[model samples]
Target: MNKTKNNFIYNIITKDLKKCKHKKIYTRFPPEPNGYLHIGHAKSILLNFNIAKKFNGICNLRLDDTNPSKENKKYVNSIKYDIKWLGFKFYYDIYYTSQYFYLLYKFSIKLIKNGLAYIDELNKHQISKYKGNFNNLGKNSPYRKRSINENLIFFKKMKNGFFNNGKISLRAKINMLSPNILMRDPILYRIKFNKHYKTKYIWCIYPMYDFAHCLSDYIEKITHSLCTLEFQDNKILYDWFLNNLKIFNKPKQYEFSRLNIEYNVISKRKLSILIKKKIITGWDDPRIVTLSGLRNRGYTSNSILNFCNSIGVTRQNSLIKISFLENFIRKELNIKSQRLIAVLNPIKIIIENFNKIKEKILIPNHPQNKNMGKRKYVFSKEIYIDNKDFKEKKTNGYRGLTIGNKVKLRYSYIIKAKKIKKDKNGNIIYILCKYYKNRKKNNVNGIIHWISKLYSIPAIFFLYYNLFKISNPENKKNFIKYINKKSLVINRGFIEKNIKNINNFSYQFERKGYFCLNKNFKNNNIFYFNRIVKLKNII
Candidate 1:
């Protein structure tokens, strides 16, 4: 069952179950194996999987790999990995559209024998010229009246690889002047001589999406065929093929608005373009919203699931602010992530009056959750604090160090700035300070986080921001032009020594945001972390 609050879709499923419309509800997430699954897909994944679990039904993960030109095993594997990472398990083995290719061809042959389909020799351009737009009416193809025998013979030849690509296609015999442009003699199958990733050279003709999708559902006995809003127009064609073939236990198609987040485009086509052009690193680039990208960026499965639930399902399309998602992640990590001090832009602070020896302080892993226990942090005479924590001269409401100002060290003692040192260029080299033994609870000056410079771990930090500067970059003529050049900022930093080999864990960098260790830097001696999100909006 979905542990989160219910949505409209769940209510519908409940009604169906009460009426005994289905003996067992079966759902499927059918994605084409052309690109990595993005965060938008996560919404659908959760909807299908959770609904199935809620009703004690089974959900199948099906790959719609009908188009071999852009499909490959790599994409198939990635799609599977992403779904699993989101904490879903398919009731059936992973299925593919290629599995029922021959069966679909038989169904097409039956449609031809029944005078419901014909082979047209029109090229793509000519076909488009005939299937008119919304404001126009379509003209019938010249080959529309071919006898069933002749059409069957031609389609068989097409399957035999006798025709060149785009030389011929099979179209359903439907209204040429239907109100819906999609139902106006839509093509059922097209000839493509490319080798398939799974079937190899056995097939030259492939069923179109409308032809394959509905029948695939019927063949699998899927009870609900959920799709994005773009497929709303195709529902007539989807039912057309099934009604024409008269398949039993026909699956019904339902459409819902897709997830759209501001400051990012989730279209697989645009994401692929970014990858091919090398504008971003890859499909798994942390800046990307791909499921793998989110996973690599340290977004937890529970947080993502909660986010999908929070948004709820709706028929109307709208853009959601990305900060809502960040807030969810922040809330989740605040309870789960350990509190650790990491200074991305460090300035050396020497405890001039200290005993010049290392001291150990026990700090709670999480300030709010004491049961998480504590870890030992080494406090030393030479320590590093964020450079931003110091000011040359005091401002009206400054929270950090200034001449003669006292501040509290987090989980430690109070510190008073005594003096500062600089080099030839007038840049402050270090700030000299003295530490007190007592912990101050009422100090007006803000508390700062720090790590011992001598015992801390050196690390490279990757700070991320929105991939595009514009909130709606997709609306632009060239979205790449709006790419945020400073999306990634690299910094050298220091972390506590106790964090060794715990790269899988995330940490709260004190006043800074949440951070997760980078997998690539594990082998190297130095640590590397990616900034998941800031503690709060700075502005």
Candidate 2:
């Protein structure tokens, strides 16, 4: 268990422990297995698991598989992998809402016998009409007056698949005139003929989320049911079920603001649409904020956890800038990632005065950390520098290579451009330069990163930008129209050849940016790199 940080949730747990409300604290992260986990889910995972660890309690991983029509084994497996990748351990074997279906069914029967619930024959539209909005009070369902025996028979028949989908539903017998619309006879269970991923065709009637969530927590003896603020209103329904059922080990639900980042869509429904339309490669597309996407894009688990912790648990909802999260990875990679020189747009620089065919130059893997050691690279007369680093016509304050101006090659000697060779299109093919050995570092106009043309390895780079052009696309009527066409740009680049253990480490590509080997093509002949982030922050 890691040292727990103080936060609003932590404060609540402390007060509970001091009051001896319970001997041990229990929490659970219950996600519907409908889509891949995203950054917003990361906040909840860390909060629930860490809260349990802080108090020497246990946190369980539960799949809220109530609506199997949208759930599947693929998502269940992905959820497990993500939670494990985030460095959390569930209390025992992974639990599922489907595992408690029998118990939940019995509880529903008890509610029918207790006259707290009834079977309604109204269709979906009629149910909505009866459950009026805040402007008017809801009218009681005609079937709300059915006897307990009659409601029990109808519920049992519905459970046995006698009723078609949406023909009949079991609704809790709550006040129809209550100002809280959700409590106005909410649906407890409905008929769904679709096959479930886990239970298959064993049953037809599945319990609704509001009916199963609180009971599942009670069955697992969960003490803290933490969810996002959207559930603040649903908390009443969550409590009503537990109270009416008279469950002994009742759990309390707590609401916290969700993690919403600027320029990104966090909703699962919208993400599914993006995938279905092939706008993204998949759930793991590097441009999105899904956990798998971030992992594939070279974001460390520590960096993500640090970001989640920095945004403390609170009740106030607000949008966070994406750059704020980028800063965490930037700071982390700055200290940990090795530095390697790479040239994105190679422009040849021929050392005319060099006599030696080739030589070895040693550069530190990390500038600040001496213990990280150094890497040796072959230096030749011919080298490749970024085309943007040189100019035929010198501009004001441009410190890069220019005619008659000296610039230092990083970790090497200072050189002055003498003349340039260009193609028929007036493009500078290469530049001729003279090198000066043992020159003072400050003597050069600027320093630039370069790769030996002879020994450099060719690699493809994928540069990622925000998926949406605007900061908040959620406000737009057609969010897809605002999709950024330049979200992903590909560039061919070269890196030092002697980079050992390349697959295991991320590298700061000298002055360009931090990059890592693309996991999709790790074993391929050609190397593929993903630009994790730039050296400096950009919106």
Candidate 3:
């Protein structure tokens, strides 16, 4: 509503409204509640909800809980939490596909009475053989010729739990030779004895996804039933059900390509395996892009919405570089987060001339925003600097600490390294330095941040890399083989003591990157922070 964007779907809705095709715009986000919502799902949510907002209409949150075996209450609650966290609200009370089970049963009965559907005696494999592939013409089932009354009796038996799972299925009487495979006598109902979380054992024969989807939209009066491109072929069947049922005010569906990100697989099945095998921590592991994962990793809702908008809605399938998302997250956090110092690989620096007294240093929490105010950190004789900031021997044009090298202690003093202390092994244990307060005279090379060794608090830092080594891990025969063993590397680090008082906001660790606390921690007084994203200019 702020400013119209150039998206084909939005343009279509605008045309529809102008032509009075719809008195008001209405859309719905239909998730199955089988798993956590991923970044791909986020795209759909934004598209539907934003389209409704743009036209001054409404959007509904509908749970398509057709297969109760995979669905559960936890998934339902998590889906709701993710939607609200993304800054969108449902227009009405939450609706479930289970709510229309009885209505769906009646429609199927009408199909049977109209001779448009029948109960198939063919087994699962036999049906597949009859419903031929692209190269072959399909043959109708032997039972396809059964009378409507007989089919109705069998279907009633199916509902009464007389048939075991996969014993019988109800199929629409579409063309057996239809070139479009989905329209070739697709199944309308299947026997599943699994107890539904919502409906319980009230019904054993549940309607198939294709049959329930269109009818649910029709029942709720959704004007636009947006879906992904994989369902384009199924659109034929989506319409067939509505038309055959003789329903009024039918909903129209439009297909757009689902979002794909490189180096990550968004499939729920693969993600479930990753969780079941304990490969990654959980669904909210920061390495993956599930909405809860992004939230736990400190990604802002506005950043995700902006990323979806920047990608633009289109029908052509494409793979977006993961950096496209990281760039937006970094851009948002740069303005919203305050700057703080943290040393991952610490090495001690002793100011030889400075006395062992702690002095307060005041620095702005945000560089450009004065309203964020300043925080006071104590600086003492001894401080911890990043191990990478120094070398026992200087490299060509190196600006960091080495023998006789002078560098500014960021926002503090220009100091020259005098000597280094080593243990039995040839590793530096500490560095000796002398401060030159007369900064005008000394040619300081560069500035590096540090934390007071005395006043700093110890915290665990999680440096996460890509979970999979291959860009398309899901395509591999064995995806677990491509899992990166070093995906999560833990390091004990130090942060400014005042960080303990910081709330649920992102903080930049100077030269390192932006980081935030892993909200899942439960240990007593032991804190852990996850690296949200490294500092890089992607734009």
> Cα RMSD to native, each candidate?
2.6, 2.6, 2.4
TM-score of each: 0.92, 0.92, 0.93
C-alpha lDDT of all candidate models, in order: 0.87, 0.89, 0.88
Root mean square deviation (Cα) for candidate 2: 2.6
Model 2, position 39: C-alpha lDDT score: 96
What are the per-residue Cα lDDT tens digits for candidate 3 across 1-539?
22246588998998998899999988999999999999999999999998888899889999999997899999999999999998998888999999999999999999999999999989989999999999998999999999999999999999999999999999999999999989889999999999899988898988889999999999989999999999998888988888888887889999998898877878899999999999877888888989998888888888898888788788999988888899999998888888888988899999999885987888888889999999998878899988888987889877788888888888788889999999999787889999876655367767888999877988889887888888777577687888889888888878888887788478988888899988777554566888999899511
Candidate that would win on lDDT: 2
On residues 1-539, what C-alpha lDDT tens digit does candidate 1 reach at each position? Answer: 24344476787788888999999998999999999998889999998998899899988899998898889989999999989888898887998999999999999999999999999999999999998888899999999999999999999999998899999999999999998888888888998878899999999889998899999999889998888898998888888888788877788778888898888988888998898899888988999888889888989888888888788787889888989989889998888888888888889999987885888888888889999888888888999988888997889888987779888888887888888999999887889998888776576488888889867988889999999998887667688989999999999988888787354378998888899978766745788899888888651
| Candidate 3 local lDDT, residue 411 | 75
Summarize candidate 2's per-residue lDDT along 1-539 as a digit string, tens digits: 23245477788899999999989999999999999999999999999998888899999999999886899999999999999999987779999999999999999999999999999999999999999999999999999999999998898899888989999999999999999999999999999999899999998999999899999999999999999999999988988898888877689888999898988998888999999999999999999999999999999888899999888888899899998999999998998888888888889999999889888988888889999898887778999998889988789998899999999888888999999999999988789999998657876789988888777888888999999999987667799999999999988878777664555568888888889889787744457889999878422
Q: Going through the candidates in order, what is the number of backbone clashes in each?
A: 0, 0, 0
Candidate 3: worst-modelled 10 consecutive residues by lDDT: 1-10
Segments in model 1 whose C-alpha atoms lie over 4 Å from true places: 1-6, 413-427, 434-444, 474-477, 501-504
Off by over 4 Å in 3: 1-3, 425-427, 472-478, 522-525, 537-539
Rank all candidate structures by their lDDT, best first, as comma-separated numbers: 2, 3, 1
Best prediction by TM-score = 3
